[model samples]
Each structure stands twice: as C-alpha cells, then as structure tokens.
Target: MFDIYNIGSLILTLSILYLSANKYHRLLKLERLENAGASPEEYNAYDKRLRLECILLIVIMGTATILSQFTNALTVAVFMIILGIILKIIINKCCPIPK
Candidate 1:
C-alpha cells in the first residue's frame, strides 16, 4: 500500500538518479573547462548556473512526488524514477553536456 515510507524511498531514488546525472555533467564540463584553460570567472558562472539547475531539479521532483501522492499513483512516480536513470545514462554516454 502507498505510504510515507514508500514515498520517501521513491524520492530518494529519484534524487540519487538525477544527481548522478548532474555529477556526470559537472565532470564533463570540468574536464572541458580545464582542457580549454577556462577563466575563473567562467567557472564561477558555470557553477552558479549548475547550482540553480540543481535547485530547480529538486523542486520539480518534489512537486511531482507531492502531486503523485494525492493521485495515489506510485506507478507514475516509479516511471519518473526509471526515466531518471535512463536520463543519467544518456547524459553520461550520448547527450552533450549543456553549458
């Protein structure tokens, strides 16, 4: 049955999956920046943007979880969780990291 524990675990799984994607993006960007000898100012800007992106990501996932609660559709949440994993893999291997 749907419960707080199940919701909590879903949130945790979603967060970990997407955060790993974010980490992959960061590493790729850092390597690119280092190879290009990017300026500290550029790095600062990138960091700020990435932080904002992460905050937005968290908010979106949290909202999604909250909405799914009322609907009692853990399946939707599970789908999102699986999607996040696929996204992580795409970020790591296929898609170019955004600036």
Candidate 2:
C-alpha cells in the first residue's frame, strides 16, 4: 500500500541520488584536471571537499531509506526534513566551491 511517506521517500531518494551522480561526475572531472598537472595540495583539497558533499548526500539518503521502514511515518518525515535542512546549512558553511 503506497502512501504519502512512500512518495516523500521516493522524491527525497531520487533527488539525493541525482546530487550524488553530479558529484561523482565532478570528481571524475577533478581527477582529469589533477592528471593534467594541477597543484597536488590544491587538487586534493578540492577533491576532499567534493567527497564530503557526497558523504552528506549519502547520509541523508540512508536516513530517509531506513526511517521509511519504521512505524512512525509522521515522525520520520519531520525528522528527515529537519535533518536535511541542518545538513544543507552545514554543507554551505563547510563546503565552499573551490575557485
């Protein structure tokens, strides 16, 4: 029986996966730049920042997936929404795009 929680989870999961895919492509691009002789320290720093963003997306995806299985649908939805917001703030503060 599909319900609102399932729909929400589906939307959240798809969007997070899209973000992850974009980040993965970017990492590939970053690797190409590094191979083309970008500075080692700077390249690694940018690579690490990109990785942290990926990790955040994965964490949210995992949380949404797991919580959707439980009984308290309302709580899970609210918690995930709040968690997403908090993580977004952290991402903005911690992961500034490299110039």
Candidate 3:
C-alpha cells in the first residue's frame, strides 16, 4: 500500500544519489584523461556519452519507480538495481580495462 510507494520513492532517491556519485567519479576519470594529454575531441566525446548515460539512468529509474506502484516494491527495486549494475559492467568493458 503506502509502504510500497514509500519504498519506491526511497529507491528513486537512492538512484539519484548513485547517479551523482557516479558522475563525480567519471569527472575524476575525465580529469585524469585530460592530464594524460588525451585529445580534446576524445574528451568531449566521453563527456557527451557520460551525459547521455546520466539522462537515460534518470529516465529508467523514474519509469521503474512508477511501474513499482503496480508491482511488488522490493522485487521491482532489486531488479532495476541489478539491471543497472549489469549495464554498468558492460560499459566498463567498453573502457578497455581488465576485469
């Protein structure tokens, strides 16, 4: 009932916090890349991609929160977070970093 909505709202709030922390981490990465003499074009492209991912994360989290209203709160939150982590892993793969 109302608890479900509360949980969903909590999940949404956490998602925003997670996104902010992630953006800060990426900004640090960007600074390091710049210090390493990465080209302006490359840096700009990476920044653009990060911005797009942030936008998409906001949309997805919002949608999931709304959908949670008609579903089980705990299950919806767990699934959305799991899926987001998997996506983050995939994006990490694209970065050429060893797993």
Candidate 4:
C-alpha cells in the first residue's frame, strides 16, 4: 500500500536528521573558532545560535516522530535507520571536521 503518512514520515525524518547534523557541525566549528582566538562576543553569539538551533531541531524531531506514528511502525523504523545513514554521509560531505 502506498501510504502518504509513510512518505511524510520519511521526509520529515530525513530533514530533521540533516538539520540536526548540520547544527552539530556548526557548533563544532564555533568551538574551533573560539579556540582560534575569536572574540568573546563573537563566540557568545555563535554559541547562542547553536543552542537555538539545537532547541529548534528537538522540537521539529519531536513533532515529526509523533506524526510518524500514523504510519506502519516497522516501515517507519527501517526507513528512519536508512535515512540516518544517508544523513551521516551528507553531514560528512557538507560539514567536515575542522583540522
């Protein structure tokens, strides 16, 4: 059966994963910048942004996961796992660790 709920679930899961990973990378980069002697004000601004991003991602993930409950449990679970791996690849490509 072609379930729209499943599709939506997949999309939301993938999006949340990507955004979360990207935010994490940004946080890491901010830390690197701080260690590289960024101004305290600049670091504080970046830190606040990172924290806001984390909170937003959490809300998005929570909402999406709740909505995903309408879909088949097993399907959602499997697709989520696959999407998570893909998200990892995207994170690596888009946000490599600072040297």
Better of 3 and 4 by TM-score: 3
lDDT of 1 at 8: 82
Give per-model TM-scores.
0.63, 0.49, 0.59, 0.42
Residue 82 local lDDT, model 2: 92
Q: Which residues of candidate 1, in runs, are more than 4 Å off?
A: 72-99
Clashing pairs in 2: none
What are the per-model numbers of colliding residue pairs?
0, 0, 0, 0
Tens digit of per-residue lDDT, candidate 2, span 1-99: 436677577757776777868777877879797788877666866777777666766677667766666647787778878987898788768766555
| Candidate 3, position 41, lDDT | 73
Model 4 alpha-carbon drift over 4 Å, by segment: 1-27, 71-99
User: What do the candidate models score in CA lDDT, each in turn?
Assistant: 0.70, 0.73, 0.73, 0.64
> What local lDDT does model 2 show for residue 70?
66
Clash-forming residue pairs, model 1: none
lDDT of 1 at 43: 73
**Model 2: lDDT to the true structure:** 0.73
Q: How accurate is candidate 3 locally (lDDT)?
A: 0.73
Q: What's the candidate order when arranged by decreasing TM-score?
A: 1, 3, 2, 4
lDDT of 4 by residue, 1-99 (tens): 556777677767767777778777987888798789987766766666555545554454554465466677676677656655665565456444343
